[model samples]
Target: MKKFIIAIDGYASTGKSSLAKQLSLHLNYVYVNSGSMYRAITFFALKNGLTPLNKENIDRLINLLPEIRLDYRTNNVTGISEIHLNNKNIEGEIKTLEVSEYVSLVAEISEIRKFVVKIQKSFKNKNGLVMDGRDIGSVVFPNADLKLFLKASEQVRAKRRYDELINEGYTVEYKDILENIINRDSKDTKRKDSPLIIAKDAVVIDNSELSINDQLDIIIRLINSEL
Candidate 1:
């Protein structure tokens, strides 16, 4: 059976990662969360004080790109791939709201996008994979066999994200999460490099009212037709 590269692109908290992971697992393909890569970079910047407060700091972070290393390792207990940065498991740190707040800023840097997009494209040479991020379909894998653009209203996405964070024991306000979602949407769409845009040929799924199983079924049927 020939395998297809699946690219899922979308705004934050639309469940792109969850959907991509499920698709990859079902198809026995490698799953990569491209956003996690950016988050890892943001996490590093925050820890090292290379924040985007000024151009000088952003330039400093850009210069240190060569020193950063990112990879995924399957967790024995969870049986899911977790990101490793600098040979340490920073996956736990990368998903925090702190990283979320900074990831879009880091992702906006053309240098950072170029750095990560190179790594993202390398996965194509290996085998079939499912990758999801803001620019996966538009920039990283423009020729991907199946492209999906997931979206939901800002209120829905923000509620989902807030619930996720709260479930993870993070103290957060719904209003703050909503503001972050709105801010991220603005930044992501306005970024000069690889701004988040639906590919012309990509299928769009507005999953605000769809259950996970329903969404999965719809996508699986589409994949089956493609296969």
Candidate 2:
């Protein structure tokens, strides 16, 4: 069996990560949540007091990039891969609303994108891989075998994110999540480097009204066709 790469790109809270993870498990591919890489860097910056990453401190952050070590380790119990920063499991830490607030800003930096993209591109060496991010298809892996661009209405995406945070024991307002989604969309699409856009040959999935299983079935069919 020949293995191929799947690149999933989309706006924040559009379920790109969820779908990509599912596909990875189903296909027995290495799953990479590219957004988590950005979040880890953002969390690091926040911990080190290097943000509101201005012109003055941006260079400092860039210099510190070599010190950042990111990798994924699968949990034996849940069988899910969790991201680690500096060999420490920071998956739980990076998922906070605080990290969410700054991730897009950190990702907008060209140097940050280049650093992460270098790591992202290396994953393709493994052959069978599923990676999801704002620019995975458009920038990181333009020749990916299958590229999916996900989209949903702002209200729907916000509600999904709010439910996720609430279930995680975080007290968050839906309005705030909605605003963040809107703001992230703007920043992601307007960024001077690697702005989020659908690859010309990519398939777009508007999952506003679809269930996870529905999405899985649809994507599985697409994968079969590709195979």
Candidate 3:
């Protein structure tokens, strides 16, 4: 059986990662979350107080991306490969709102995108993989066999994000979360390097009103046909 590369691209907190992971496991394919590459960079920036304006610093960061290995270690109980950055398990830290603020800023850097793209390509060489990020379908893996662009209304995505932050013990406002989502969408779409856009051949999954199981079924059917 020939394997197909599944590329899922979407905005933050849109459940793209969850769906991608499930599909990968079901199909026995490798699952890669490309956004974590940028998040790991932001984690480094915050630790070193490196601002986005520092072009040289960003370039230095790019040079170091190869050292930031994103290993996924499944939990002893929950059975999920928690994201790890540079031998350290920073999944809890990377989910914070501050990381959210800087991710787009860092992602907009061309050098950073170039560096991350290099890693993404290595994982897709055999094509039995599912990768999700803002640019996977349109830029990083445009030749992927299947492309999914997931989206929802701003209000819906914002509320989901707000609840996620609260559950994570962050003191945040719903209004602020909504605004942040809007700002991120604008920034992501306006980004110079591989801006977020629906590819011409991409299948649009408007998950605005669907449950996870329903969404999974729809996508599974689409992929099964191709496989």
Candidate 4:
């Protein structure tokens, strides 16, 4: 069987990561949750006190990008990658509301994208890999054998995100999350570098009305057809 790159692109809380994980497992491929990389960078910037406009500080931080390592680990009998920076696992910390708020800001930096893209490219090498993120299909792996763009209504996505955060004990308002989703959608589409766009040959999936299994079945069918 020839290895191929699988790119999943979508907005926040659209279940891109979840579906990617399932597909990777089914195919025995490596799964890279690209958003976690952005969140890790956001956590680093916050801890180092580098605000959005602090170019020098941000550049200095990017230089340390090589120290970031991500790997899947079994925890509590479930498998998920532990994101490490300089040898310390910051998975739990990086998923906080603070990191969530500033992640898009850090992600807008072209320097950071370049730094991470280099790492992502190396991982795909001749691809038996599943990678998911905002611009994965269009930017990170444009030539991927299979590409999917996932989307859902703003209210639906916000509700899902709010519920997830609430379950994790994060204090958040549903309306506020909805507003943030709109704001992120704007920024993600308008960003100067590698803005999110559905690639010409990709399939668009509106998952708002679909169950997880439905979505996964659709994607698996698409992948099979593509292959």
Give all TM-scores, in the order shown: 0.97, 0.97, 0.90, 0.90
Q: What would the TM-score be for candidate 1 when compared with the true structure?
A: 0.97
- Overlapping backbone residue pairs in candidate 2 total 0
User: How many Å off is the CA of 202 in candidate 3?
Assistant: 0.7
**Best candidate per lDDT, number?**
2
Compose the digit string of candidate 1's lDDT tens values, residues 1-227: 68878899988899998888777877778888899999998988999998654899999999999999999888788656789998999777777788888888898898999999988888887577889999888888888988999999999999999999899889999999999999999999999999999999999999999877888899889877876
Report the lDDT of model 1 for residue 178: 94
Which tens-of-lDDT digit does each residue in 1-227 have in candidate 2?
A: 78999899988999988888778888888899999999999999999998777887788899999999999998888566889999999988887888988898999888889999999888888859999998988889999988999999999999999999999899999999999989999998998999988899999999999987899999999877876
> Runs in model 3 with CA error above 4 Å?
52-67, 74-79
RMSD of each: 1.0, 1.0, 2.1, 2.1
Q: Return model 3's CA RMSD, one decimal.
A: 2.1
lDDT of each: 0.88, 0.90, 0.83, 0.81
Clashing pairs in model 3, backbone N/Cα/C closer than 3 A? none
Candidate 4 collision pairs: none
